[model samples]
Target: MSTTEDLTKDLSRIMQLAASDPHDIGPLLNYGLDWMLRLAPFDLVAVFLLESDHLVVKAARGPLADARVLRHAISLDNFTSIREALATCGPRLFYEEDHAHGEGDPFDGVLDFPHGHACMVIPLCFGGNAQGIITFDRERCGTYDSQTIQLVEIYAQVLAMAIHQAAQSQLLHQLMRESNERERILREEHQAGDLLSPLQSKNPAVRELGERARQVAPTPTPVLIHGETGTGKEGIAAFIHQWSERRRQPMVKLNCAAIPESLLESELFGVVKGAFTGAVKDRPGRFRMANGGTLFLDEIGELPLPLQAKLLRVIQEGTFEPVGSDRTIKVDVRILAATNVNLQEAIGERRFREDLYYRLNVFPVQLPPLRQRLEDLGPLCDSLLGRLGRRLGKPPLLLSENTLARLRQYSWPGNIRELGNLLERAAILARGSVLTPNLFDLSHSSDVKAGVGESPTPSADASAEAPMISLDEAQKRHIRMVLNRVNGKVYGPGGAAEILGLKPSTLQSRMKKLGLERKVHFEA
Candidate 1:
């Protein structure tokens, strides 16, 4: 028989072990129950809980019950005293004299089993909710003393708290797992949607060019863009600026050809107040305004040779004196120059400075004309038409197969800018939802409609068959057809460039080259 001293010492040892590792709750619970049973001399202890539809064995000692215990009804009749004790908020004790088994005791004839026994049922409560019941039985012991029953009740309270904490932890883990999975799915969908956007380039050449531009955008190199006019040169320059280290700063643009040679110097290097007849207040030049940013000079080839020297000095040394001012201003700027004219040819003719050309040509990117990449027309047209429809506040429009086919065959000399303008005009003028062929007119056509027979044979029939229209007359008729198709709105929407498959800039240049301006007058 264990004395009280031994029980106290054993309890102290178990408490020390439990305190050593609070993290290992499973082992701590089982070890605690085992130590308590050895010291307190209990025959069996059963820990069961009604969870969902099954009665689960949570913790146990001795041959009390198997882990796969079946679920049982919990009515007042089956466990009268147990239910009564739960309502009374105390443990229930059945004395050996009062105990009775109603025809269901499997171990009745076993060595340590007895039909009549003493047992106590303690209700497990956590946060005011009844979780389960704990039972301790003794075959020979008459009944548990009050002190022993009180100790058993204290153990049940601690065990219930641990079980409740474990359940909450499991729920939190499940919620975190589900949240992580949802975030991963959202990221995947976002990436897939990005891949389907119109700006996602599939053309190898364009893709490579875009990648290269991105790589160079962070640098402060002087980028020289070579492409025909109306190819969105300024847009590319703006993109480079936006992606560069100086994105937060301003990007100043100067049209080298638009400002006259006499005023170009003052325009670039600002004049002091009252220095010139039109000068009212002191103003900053392009270079000064673009300090710590970018300066995009379009039509760089048109800069006069005299002003080129001053521009070159500023670009090379970052020091320039404003016109009519002796004070020199130093600026940190990224120079991006664009031109449609051949600079090398201009330099050979002494029209452009060779040294300045080399300075600006440090990083050159040649944009391919739209005619070279005809495959991108479909997506480009779709995007342009969608934007145009939105801007015009009209129903969505679709280009007919014949119209698209004709567009693909036409040489788009003006590139994307021309295409956008064409769509805008077509959206406004289109009578129905479809852009038909009659809304578009092709320029630079060969004489396919003219009869290709040999010279007329001498006869009345031959004279009647001979065409009276001369080549010049045919050329005038073609020009009129092109103009009529564009609705006479030149330079922007519904322009000659849309009909001629040329950029507006390109059309203007071609009109100059072909002397079309002499025959056709442009209304302001």
Candidate 2:
């Protein structure tokens, strides 16, 4: 048994907890039950809150139950004593002798234990309102002294106040979040369009690009389309094939960067049944599938040096021998390659072969980024919004004039793909027919300079505007800076890999691609 001083300390601790202004109601229920059980000799104690119309067990403790015993619940209709406690806003004591078959036992049909011989349900009340009942049960059929009951009632009052305050705070936070999101939606606007079909824009640059593709479609000369990521290089390749003589034949597509180096050769050329382990069946690679048609190889710059020589051989002689086979298969396939990588820089780094570059770059087509082609924004939005709205079950989505102006001022790092995705998201969030987006909704914020690739800002030393550095150059600087900070440690805690959030193997691969060998950069 605890002394009078101990009980007084517990009451004060609960009172202080109620005054602390908590955001969650769970802690109050748990802490209150811990103290309530100590006031009397109790084998079981559980707190239940009236949520909607059901009395749900929120927190509990006993030899038969753990602190997280919230899986039990009962409706007020099935709980006569609990309903009486909530209705009178007072505590009611009961015994097994008074109710036959434990008809109104709070834990009846809820827990797989006896109702015990004696139990009581106390209404959790504050400000003349009640939300739930707290249950106390004991093994022996007996009475709780008036002093103990009085002490428990006082604790209940403090607990009820604490739960009320925390619930109000929780409700307030939810409302504030909803209110903030609504306010943000009202302040910005955008419209979207789909690019599943070919782009026929009013812009002369876009028109000329389409005409150029049509002109080259008739020739056997290989073409390479190059641009920043998300500028739609794949679309250009498809457009050329659509107008080509081999349009009826299959135009097989492969992304050279997506596959591992060890298996890349097998993917490009056919593989025999016993080429390598797990090669149980012979497979005709992408080249054989696209025979008599066109083969579009995206991210061609990522092709390994050894594979590059083989790719060149296929282009020159139109012949390739499958792995682990002596027979040579001939295919008259026209290759169309695409790359975001600056291959000139890749060749200088020796990551890309110089001979292979000339073979693929027979004719090059550079697609202008979305930021440079603002003339197409209005039409693009109108076209994409209708498709997006219909797809999302919100038809005919529209954009404001102010949104178009805002779009022009911002630099689009992801280009047209980013633009389409942004619009689709806005349509999903839009309350009505009009869609609005927050000004800084883009992945790259406003600080990213506008027309980044179109024209570079002037250098401090030079009188003329300096060209923007290539993406590879930027990555090299960032990686080297981290390496220097870690004293050139490539693995382990506080090393370059940890700082960069990259696996050591992945870091090694990137370093190799950028020609950043350990001996060359770290030691030389």
TM-scores, all candidates, are 0.46, 0.46
Q: Tens digit of lDDT per residue, candidate 2, span 301-400? A: 9999998998999999999987766678899898999999899999999999998899889889988777546667778788777777766888688875
Clashes of each: 1, 5
Clashing pairs in 1: 414-503
lDDT for position 469 in model 2 = 51
| CA lDDT of every candidate | 0.65, 0.72
Clashing pairs for predicted structure model 2, backbone only:
189-436, 192-384, 192-385, 193-384, 194-384
Cand. 1 Cα-lDDT: 0.65
RMSD in Å for model 1:
27.9
- Best candidate per lDDT, number? 2
Tell me the tens digit of each residue's lDDT in model 1 across 171-223.
46544644564455334333322111212455566667666677788998888
TM-score of 2: 0.46
lDDT score for residue 471 of model 2: 47
